[model samples]
Target chain A: MIAGIPISKNSYQALVLSVLGIALVLIMLLSLSLGAYAIPFSSVLAILGEQFGLSLEGVDRSAANVLLQIRLPRIIITLLIGGGLGIAGAALQGLFRNPLVEPGLIGVSSGSALFAVVFIVLVPGLVSGSLIQNLGMPLFAFLGGLTHVWAVYQLARTQGRTDTATLILAGVAINALAGALIGLTLFFADDSALRSFTFWSLGDLGASSWGKFPVAIALIGIPSIMLMLEYRNLNALSLGEREAFHMGISVQRVKIKTLILSALIVGVGVSLAGMIGFVGLVVPHLIRIGFGANHRLVLPASFLLGAILLNVADLMARTVVSPAELPIGVLTALIGAPFFIYLIFKLNKINS
Target chain B: MLQAEDIHFCIRQRPIVKKASISVNPGEILAVLGPNGAGKSTLFKILAGEISCTRGQVDYNGQNLKALKTHQLASVRAVMPQHSTVSFPFTAREVVELGLPKDSKRNSERNIREVMELTKVVHLEDRLYQQLSGGEKQRVQLARVLIQIWEKKPFPRYLLLDEPTSSLDISQQHIVLDILKKLKSQNIGVLIVLHDLNLAAHYADRIAIVKDGLIAGFGKVEEVYSETLLSEVFDHPIRLVRDQETQQILVSSNSKFHSDLKISKQAQA
Candidate 1:
């Protein structure tokens, strides 16, 4: 019960969750409305109201098209990817017991990207503008993510256990190796392949549509939800693996399940949104700072906060240099780097 | 009572613990004494169900340790490792609360409060776990394990501790041993790993000395502890002699006397 926090253990989590929920809805509406077309908030609501058969009038046809056809899909993808990465990051941080571990830094997405590149270069027939190809990319990406993480896990494991330092070192080595492979692919890829690879590397959300929405949701949403449900087990793991086992938690199961689930979510995210970095790492850290490290609070809160963060970053990407859009990935780094530095400073001050 | 018989543990084709057989009965503290690398912690791990033994069986009451469900074993015993490291900056209160089982009918908050008070960590309820001193952390972990087996059931429960007193000061060590002693009154058996021979000699009702991954001696303190047995187990000359006035047996390492005698003999020569 820190004075400024005002959260008493049990009810505090519910209250924060409700608040985050409302804020997420508000941000979602704002993101759907404020873009290149500048649709009014009232019009956005009117467009949404029509879905419920309220039939609100006075909506411009073009604004409706912009809201439904363009912005709605982007927002959905952003919300899912953001939420997925956030919870994955939180679970991973809990598993590794290190605050600095994240999907972006740990080569999970790099693994997905590398695999997606391989699919594009090695098996171009699988992704030739067909619905199945669009679906096949995320599947290949998931396998890539699984492979990279599996390799890292194998490398980090010594005597049947994973230590934090070894895991970190393995992640670094995997990330470097994936980067080299990606660079090698980029060298020989043709024009269209090169363009797709470049956009995927920088994380382009412009290609999002209702067509790929269901696939992304199935991959990212399910795993993220599964991770969220293990909040108690994850909290138990904070006490280290041995203590967690004594507390009746299946520690090895938790590790394997979380690693696989996070890899899937991160892989799907990379395939759909390209390499949107820092949402996973930054969002969970911020949520933990605000709501203590209880996984019950941290997991769900990270989800909502992650969506809010990515939506805002995507908004900035669209509007900051109006008519000339910046990559969403670049904007997130711009936002995330300063906050990372601030976290380091805050941690140093606390230690002193 | 908890019983482990003929336990053999190996890692990478190397034997770490060999042919160890021991048991802790109700109303007694079994202190395991062993030098470093003698596999004391590994034995605790096997008994605590943290790892499976290569060969042997651990039984609680009549149920095989490996056969018992997690929740069933959880109700029967709790284990505190040699070092407890928590990642997040959990409040000491939160750390204790993590011990409560999902289906436990006991009032969790009350148990947390009572155990914290019992372990003398109530004052540290608000402090972050990582910020606590080593002794404080050990006490907090002790409180957690105590909370797990706090409720008295129809059957006896067990608590396995690995060097519980390693980080505590002399007074704190006494407090912990006293707490373990109190637990015996409630029919809870405790298996504690101890490095201090004197502490084990005084507090433990039974002592099991492990040497080179094998049990060198195991029995009631007075029956098993002798000059030759301890000296051989510890690789140091030891003597168990009665004090003339107190009529209580004292454990003496005798290093000073032996070294002095060597110097006198050199001078004479």
Candidate 2:
């Protein structure tokens, strides 16, 4: 009534979010229906029903297995990984109070990639026969992500304050160090291991399995909820640290919690998909610009928007060359870079 | 009442606020007026509990200021610094809403509208805060601080402003000072640091002249604005004249002993 708009503010936000969520779901279903062995939409839904113990008619066994065992996991993994990256990006941007700050901008991706490479290259023989090898890559990647962010946190903190400039500087230094270490690991890798590491670093959601779903859920879901709970606090923080303190927020505690939550989300995302970029940075910015700066709406919108972007990017990655897939990371960065440059110029023009 | 006893502060081992002592009673408007580098902002920071005093105690309403949690301090006092920059664009209404409690008694939209209107920023409510001009941003910030201090019932509220109207034009400066004067009628303790001497003389019930990180003088406005005190504190001459029609003090020209002084003596005779 005040703004003379058609819908209530909260309803408008909810409507937009629902539409995005439905679009993401539809894109995922479409993703499952595509592939070299194109399955029909009906068959895809049937396989989904079968997996959930619902009796569905005319569901072919081979098609069901392919949809359930392969396409379904890949799609789910893409959604989870993309959503996690988006939330992480939003949280980090809020924490740093800068739209330019992304999870990867602070070296979490490279740190995780370096450790993932180490795990793959040094223990190729162990992964060949070990059941735990299924968990090894993600576990090591998570640990690496945790370690890098912790170092960045420590470096950014001075007298109980996290200076954004210092944090960015530390991230640059750590990213370079991690990059060098990853290169060293690549030199000793055998041909097969090298290829695997290369693909992992470039990032792919091609290795999704039912066994990995629980891990992804635990890693992404927990932190996502935690970050969402901190939404109000993050909104206060956008007013700046001093104002946030005046609003009765524990500024130090909130910063640490946000950083840790972001780290966890980034770790889970990198473990699942190697090192996807741009989703976390671009999705949150897009949401903030479209909506307002309220994190209550921004965070959830970011999650849905992120899922859609990644799914669409994955769709492009898999279908562009057909059978010989382009890495999802390459597609995201290729698209994200130009868009990011355009955004910068647009912002500059607006300022001028 | 707000009290600071022997507050000592240093930045990088250089003393900024050295053993400063002051107190403000309820319904009082205390102005801290000083020249550049007088550490008025630092003193305000100490009172707001933004920084810890090296060797002093700040007591607010019988509770130790340092002991109270950040949220508790926020509930009691609202501080507006000289400059604020938000990296992202937020609507003016949204910015004002940040000051209210999450479960505020009044409707958030209505309250935002009230504060924006009071600050004469009602039309700018939908405008992006960052896109607004500097004076507009200052007014929005004033609205934010006012909403922060406003509550359902009358309680002892502390409003701390640091050069709030520095970015505003002459007319806007009067608008902000008038708002501060109105707050005094509501029995709120208003503490403001102002560079304009005449504004402080007109609006502030008491003036605390700070010099070299210390209170050079603190008393009634008339007592603090004497020629000797003004010249000594500023290290420059300022002529103070009283208007016969309005009986208001006007400061003009920077002369140590001018024609205005002779006029002041003649008017007293």
True contacts kept of each: 0.70, 0.61
Off by over 4 Å in 1: A2-7, A122-129, A341-352, B11-15, B241-248, B257-269
Q: Write down the lDDT that model 1 would get.
A: 0.85
**Model 2: residues with Cα > 4 Å off, grouped in runs:** A1-4, A51-54, A125-136, A153-169, A350-352, B105-107
* Per-residue lDDT of candidate 1, residues A1-352 (tens digit): 5577756677878888899989889988988888778988898999999988989879789989988998999998998988888898899899877787888777898999998898777665533557766788889898999888888878888866677678889999999999899989878888778777777678788788888888888898888889899998999888887788888887889888998999998898898888878888898898877778999889988988888888888888888897677888998888887887887798678769
* Predicted candidate 2 versus true structure: per-residue lDDT over B177-232, tens digit per residue: 88777777565788999999988888888999999999999999878788787888
lDDT measured at residue A123 in model 1 versus the true structure, 0 to 100:
61
Cα shift from native, residue B93, model 1 (Å): 0.9
Per-residue lDDT of model 1, residues B63-148, tens digit only: 99889877678888999887888888788888888888777655777777778888899999888898998788888999988888
